[model samples]
Target chain A: MIGVELRKLFRRPRTWATIAVLNALPVLVAVLLQLTDLAPRPGEGPPFLSAVLTNGALFPLAALAIVLPLFLPIAVAVVAGDAVAGEAQAGTLRYLLVRPAGRTRLLVAKLLAVVAFVLVTVLVVAAVGYVVGATLFEAQPTGGTSVSGTSLSQEELAGRSLLAIGYVTVSMLGVAAFGLFFSTLTDSPLAAALGALAVLVTSSLLFTLDAASPIAPYLPTRYWLAFVDLFRDPVLWRDVVRGLALQGVYVGVLLAAAWANFTTKDVTS
Target chain B: MSAVIRTTGLVKRYGRLRAVDGIDLDVRAGDVYGFLGANGSGKTTTVRMLLGLVLPTAGEVELLGERMPRAGRRVLPRVGALVEGPAHHGHLSGRANLSLIDAAGPGGSGRTRRARIEEVLDQVGLGGIDRRPVRAYSLGMRQRLGLAAALLRRPELLVLDEPTNGLDPQGITEIRELLLELNRRGTTVFLSSHLLAEVEQLCTRVGVLDRGRLVLQDELVRLTAPTGATVVSTPEAGRVRAVLDGRVLGVDGDRVVVRGADPAEVNARLVAAGVPVSALALQRPTLEEVVLAAAGTSADRVEAPR
Candidate 1:
């Protein structure tokens, strides 16, 4: 049932448009970073482009962090946000619910669709960044030594890229879960989408503030960039674990709330 | 026949407003029961409670012989519904929408599922719209599609709220006849609507609600013929008055007699007396009048089950 929902999400024009536009953004950013004086000289350390790309897994990981608040979150929101509210607005929810299918099943299917959309959005960003960054910056990927005093083979680059995509994908699940959470609360898709984005943006801002807060670990957004640490020589699994734990908590709470609200909703509106 | 759906002391309160206020109901098996009320009259709210979408503040709902809010999962399978509006995935074609829904149930071979889809589409007069995207369908067509989806499971109990909404007269007639046929096949229907005449024509039993409370409930015939019309007519007004003076019937001009009696006898007597009666027509009270009268008179209000 959820796979069917995922297919519906992919077929939507807005979903494709969001992916296309976001994919082009990183390419443009990479080009701009290379033209500036801030970029590294031939022998200098990794520049801003390299900071994003050559940090091996950190390149796409950084790209995800940049896109999540403005691009990825909204994309997830559009998909998840429309779950119930969009159905109600389109005058199709009542028809769907009338089936022998339980409301809980419908809610789960919609949430899972949103999660799939989020993963797809992250992969699009990572793939686009890899192609554009590798072509424009010509920097050898960091970590292992270079062969022939240059960058590694194509297979090595592909392996590193896939790992980066994986990190970005898992990290964005929080955004998708939150989007689904907001979807159950509103009858308007636009409202649910924008409302969920607002929450993501606010939490990201609070998480990055330079305050000496003891509660940072509890903020789900704090782990948004934790994927960057995964590319280290000795992979720092602590932040990755913390990020996964934080995401699990968000998913658990949001999904539970959605189930409770939707199952009991009057929905006459 | 035993009631297939019953509600005792059902109350649903949203903040300070009581959407469904202590309404009791009994719908027997195979009944084409009409639920009548104006907008915001709590008809939809009551149905939602029965469907287990909204919890009742205080009540017991028994559907298909099991108590609701507790045995909802057990009872819901035998029941099907189209609560208020037509809801479907706009991106998917109509056939795909139906197929997706059918897949969620006990898995079946593709051929059987497609056949089931075709059956409902044909039943609801939507056989030609199987391939069109649901977004392209007009409101009436979408309503028919919604009905088709409800019938896909071959549910024993069909609960539809305003099933005729957005439908043209012809479409309404078609749905009404289809419902009648379904009832004949032993499928109980619980339909909600503000159209009283349609209810009068299609429903055997009805429950009239007003402002979140049930004002009347009974077999349609009982409400329509509470007391038949009584017409008394005579060519000479003075003679008619003299004959009916202090009689136990309503007197209007040259006519007088007990209400609900046939007018033929009154007209025959006038003609025999060389009175040359101009006209005598019986006026039967309608369901609208009964509903209106019931809504107005507190004495006629029936208490809901507790």
Candidate 2:
């Protein structure tokens, strides 16, 4: 069933089209910055944007920062939200259920497929950023300076970059979980996607308000950018750890809800 | 013969509305069972329950000797079905859709998947179909594609609901022949439709539903058996009625209904009396008449609250 789902997910042109369109923004940012040497001031405008001007190797992290705020999550939400609801809308859910795919097993396969989409999308964005950075800017063979004002070794930089990518992927999964949970609740893919986005938008909105600060740490998007701390001199594990735990909780809880609802609900469509 | 599909008092209720009232459905092996009902009479709901797509509110469903919605994994692979209408991903080709559905479950072996798809496509008269996506296919083509998906595994029993929905006259005839041929090779069929003519022509046994209730179920032959009368068509209908005076039930435009189950006896009597008989046959109820008599008015009709 997992194999079948992966085939269905990757075989469609829409999946790849989404990945391509997602990379376009980061690539566009790279081109604009390449044409004009002006970079955003330090500590402002996408976490690592100012740093990517000097160290082309840092562009991958810069690209992650650029899209992580909106594009990536929206893409994940749409795909994950469409998982069950899209099938229902297409009238294929009944056929799949009658195929006896086993409700629990189908849900797990769909979640994995969504995770795979996130992983691939993140990788492609990072890869395009790397190529764009290398071609447009000077190489920092000696290793780029960390945000903490320390010069990191080449291997150390690569290791930390990979960690940041993994972190971002996990955070996006938090969005996917919300979408998947909503997917099981409604038969409209648009509604499910919007529902998932609503959660993220609400979390993001609440994170900025002083009144919401009391409960800020518990928000799903709160630790989304915690990966930036990976570039610290000694590495700041504080919010990073919290973000991972928070996403884990969301994924677990939302997935459980999706399963409980899907396995028992009647497939009238 | 063993029963292929047996439901004992199967019931499904959506709140206060009993979509599928308590009803027993018995479909034996090698039977072309036609399930007849009006729109909103819960035919689709019952089909869903049988396949475990919709759970029964009360009672039970068993397919191939195993309890349903429970033993579905063990049993559904052997039962092919097309519920409501055909549904497929519009973006993909018919073949792609078939492979995906075939791969979704256990029993469809990946190695033989292509061959199975090809065979079923041929069986459903789409063997020469091109690589065009299903979105471009006409309604008839889509219905055939749906049938091809159902037949991919060569299931032992087929449960098709309104299988001929969008087909032209020729397409309908072709599908009827295909279904009959499949049944000839020992495949049991449970066909649900509101087309009484289709059911009358193909069914060995029939069940009728009216407003969520199973109003009638019996062998098609039994349901349409001779009504202890004979019909005679003649230009001299008046002379025949005069001869069979007391036995004449009714007369309508050169056709006379006489109180005799034996057509041969009626013919002999008419010939002996010098009343030329153009046609003489024992009266048997048509499936439409039988269904109309057994079931109530259309369930789609809404009445004002008393």
Candidate 3:
């Protein structure tokens, strides 16, 4: 099932198109940064390139932010949302359902496929951003300067980069689960994808409000970029734990609702 | 014989319209049972219910002796279905679509899967269709591919909703032959179509549904057998009706037609009644007539089965 799903993922033109566009955004940002006088002057132990490194983190984050509202969640929704609905629309649901594999097994296989797609997509953004950052900024031996007046060593920076990327991956998982849940609700992949994006965007908007501060921390959107704290002199585990926990809750709730609706749907349309 | 498929009071409603109203049906093991119904008469809905793809609002369904919805997983392994229109990922090659389902179970190594695929494809006359993308396949070829998928698992029961739909004459004949061959090998076949001729030629037993209700269910031969033959001799028509009894047989015009009496006996009774019968001939209702009478519509309802 995984092999089949992977083949399906690669075959879709939209999948590759999304990846290509995402990979280019950071490079474009890198080009613009190179042309402008936005960095610290050279000969300052750390040159202008190093100054951009502080901003390098933003490339992936920005890419994610822009992509999340329209592309990331939509991508997740496109793949996961089509899990059952697409097959139903294509008339293949009956064929798959008749197989020896149970419905739960089929759903799990598809859900995992969506998760795998999410992982690959997030990795693409990380790889593209890192490569572009390295090429444009020049290699720096040090990690990054911490927010609390401390500097991170080379090894520490690599660790933080990995941690940050990992956190982003986690955040994307919530999107995938939510997309899969909507996929079971409707026969249109576009509808499912858009629906998941709508939910993510709505929740994200709510998270940005000061009035929502007390409850915002509990939202999945709130934890999306929490890994930035990992680069701090003393890493803040509070936000990290809270974010991971919130994402887990979202995944659980979404998957549970999906399973419930799927098992009971009449599936005529 | 053990029933391979059975349904009791199965119902499915879409808002106010009951797409599949209360229905009770049975298909015996190794039996090629024809489900005769017009479009929107719930044939597709019923098949979806058996496959667990559609939930029923009320009643029970059992496939291969296992109750439905609960035993769905266990029963699904033994059944293969093609509901309504044949559908697949248009961008993928025919082989790829089957491979997706193949990977789902039986755990065959790549070589085993390829070999099985080849065999099924050959069986369906889709031997070279594997290399072509589904988007390029003709309607007939797609139907064949759908059948090939169903045959992949060597299922004990095959539920095909309009298996011959959208096929040319040659394609139709080929599928009919293939289905008969499969049945000969002990696979129970359950098929639904609006074509009475196809069902008459292929099925041993049949069930008729109209407006979501199973109004008639019986063997094909029994349902299509002549209600009774009419013997006409202007004056003896009424006398013939009297001899056979008005309830069992009646005179219409110059002929005596029995509603549910054997033609031979009715003829014998008329001869002994001293009615000068000018003509004595047997008339048996065709499959179309039975279906029409059951459906409560003109013979137009028998348009085409697949």
- Among these predicted structures, which one has the highest TM-score? 2
Q: What would the C-alpha RMSD of candidate 1 be, to one decimal place?
A: 4.9
Better of 1 and 3 by lDDT: 3
**Isolated chain A TM-score, each model:** 0.82, 0.99, 0.86
lDDT per residue (tens digit) for residues B24-120 in model 1: 9999998899998877788888988887767788989999999886776566657778878667777778788878766654433467888989999
Evaluated on CA atoms against the true complex, candidate 2 attains a DockQ of 0.81
DockQ for all candidate structures vs. native: 0.46, 0.81, 0.46
Which residue pairs clash within candidate 1? A52-A59, A91-B86, A92-B86, A92-B87, A92-B88, A93-B87, B228-B260, B229-B260, B230-B260, B232-B255
lDDT per residue for candidate 2 within B35-107, as digits (tens), equals 9999999999999999999889999999999999899999999989999899999889999999999999979
Model 3 agreement with the true structure over B95-175: per-residue lDDT tens digits: 988888777754345678888888999999988664768999988888888888888878899999899988999889989
All candidates in order of DockQ, best leading? 2, 1, 3
Docking class of 1: acceptable
Give the per-residue lDDT digits (tens) of candidate 3, residues A1-269.
Answer: 66666777778777788778766755675687677846444334222233564545334444554455455666676777787788778867666666655667777888887777788888887777666776666555555566555877878777776787688778888888888888888888778888877887888888878887887776667776566577567998888888888889989998999888887777675
DockQ for candidate 1 = 0.46
Q: After superposition, how far is residue B45 of candidate 2 from its true place, in Å?
A: 0.3
Question: Which candidate do you rate higher for lDDT, 1 or 2?
Answer: 2
Clash counts per candidate, in order, are 10, 0, 5
Off by over 4 Å in 2: B272-274
| Top lDDT prediction, candidate number | 2
Better of 2 and 3 by DockQ: 2
Q: Which residue window of length 10 is worst by lDDT in model 2 chain B?
A: B236-245
Q: Which stretches in model 1 have alpha-carbon errors above 4 Å?
A: A30-48, A51-66, A130-160, B104-111, B226-229, B232-239, B243-248, B251-264, B278-283, B297-306
